[model samples]
Target: MYGAETWRTTTTTIKKVQIFINSCLRKILNIHWPDTISNSLLWERTNQLPAEEGIRKRRWKWIGYTFRKSSNCIARQALTWNPEGKR
Candidate 1:
């Protein structure tokens, strides 16, 4: 539950949120869910890419290249924001 207020109840909610986010991203990118082996290989490849290449390069090379710039910005903001409103 990772420090959630109610461990047992929150776990299910967390899983559902994760699944929903994953599905949304997949649909937005028009990509299939990766198999276990492919997923591992993808992480390995991502690590090999240069950090200086920036988000656009990585997003295009790995994630769906078709994502609009503004959508990516909004997604990044949503992911990085804390629920408590603290930086």
Candidate 2:
């Protein structure tokens, strides 16, 4: 998630990230093979946020940061830019 702030996320991407995180958490918790844990429980135990929420937070935080930058910033302009185009 290092550059997640610039990612164009979709359902599949988010789900893949979540699955990877869940597997890592399970390994870290030594819950393997016969052991099982619900996703909600795992999140609760680790105080973790889902991929979607985490990425969304990161994106929003980045957006806010960009907004706080000088008006001439390219990132800030990109956020407020509404191109005159058609679908």
Candidate 3:
């Protein structure tokens, strides 16, 4: 059995560790994407280019979550549209 003093020290150490871990997790989840210096001028440059080239340049990459949700939505729609098992 731990003495009273030892029990108090151990509890304090555990609380400190928990606080440090919670702070780290908050920092990791709140990460922001940095903007480039030319980001502000992108609109002007795109406007001067041809329509097809401008559209290509304006395309943004999708994250994994976006793709997963899109696929799930498509599957649900397909199932709803196809009542029979033909699909």
Candidate 4:
């Protein structure tokens, strides 16, 4: 799915990884993971916050275990690697 000059597949892959990561994070964080099968915006927004912040803030103990896997990737893509880009 890697088409020329398009990050659609990359973005989609990142999103899916994000969803699965969020699910596992919720379970590990002692939060009740939900299984509702509706498309209500209210439920959607409600379910998004904790996981969003948790990821953003790196709020997990097991995160330390994954730091090794993420560190190199993050460093490679980080703004410092592209000085012209905003930090």
- Please report the candidate that would top TM-score against the real structure: 2
Q: Select the stronger candidate by TM-score from 1 and 4.
A: 1
lDDT of model number 4: 0.45
Estimate, for each residue in 1-87, the C-alpha lDDT of model 1 and write its tens digit: 133321333456655654554454445545674632343344354453222223335445533422334555765455456687568
Q: Where does model 3 exceed 4 Å of error?
A: 1-9, 31-87
How many clashing residue pairs, candidate 2?
A: 0
Question: Which 10 successive residues of model 1 have the least lDDT summed?
Answer: 1-10
lDDT of 2 by residue, 27-46 (tens): 99999978898999999999
Per-structure clash totals for the candidates: 0, 0, 0, 0
lDDT of 4 by residue, 6-50 (tens): 232355665675577566555555556374333233336446543
Worst window of 10 by summed lDDT in candidate 2: 78-87
Which residue runs of candidate 4 sit more than 4 Å off their true CA positions? 1-9, 33-87
For candidate 2, report its TM-score: 0.90
Candidate that beats the other on lDDT, 1 or 3, i.e. the better one: 1
Compared with the true structure, what per-residue lDDT tens digits does model 3 show for residues 1-87?
Answer: 122222323456655644454444445445334633232234343343323332333332222323456545864355346466675
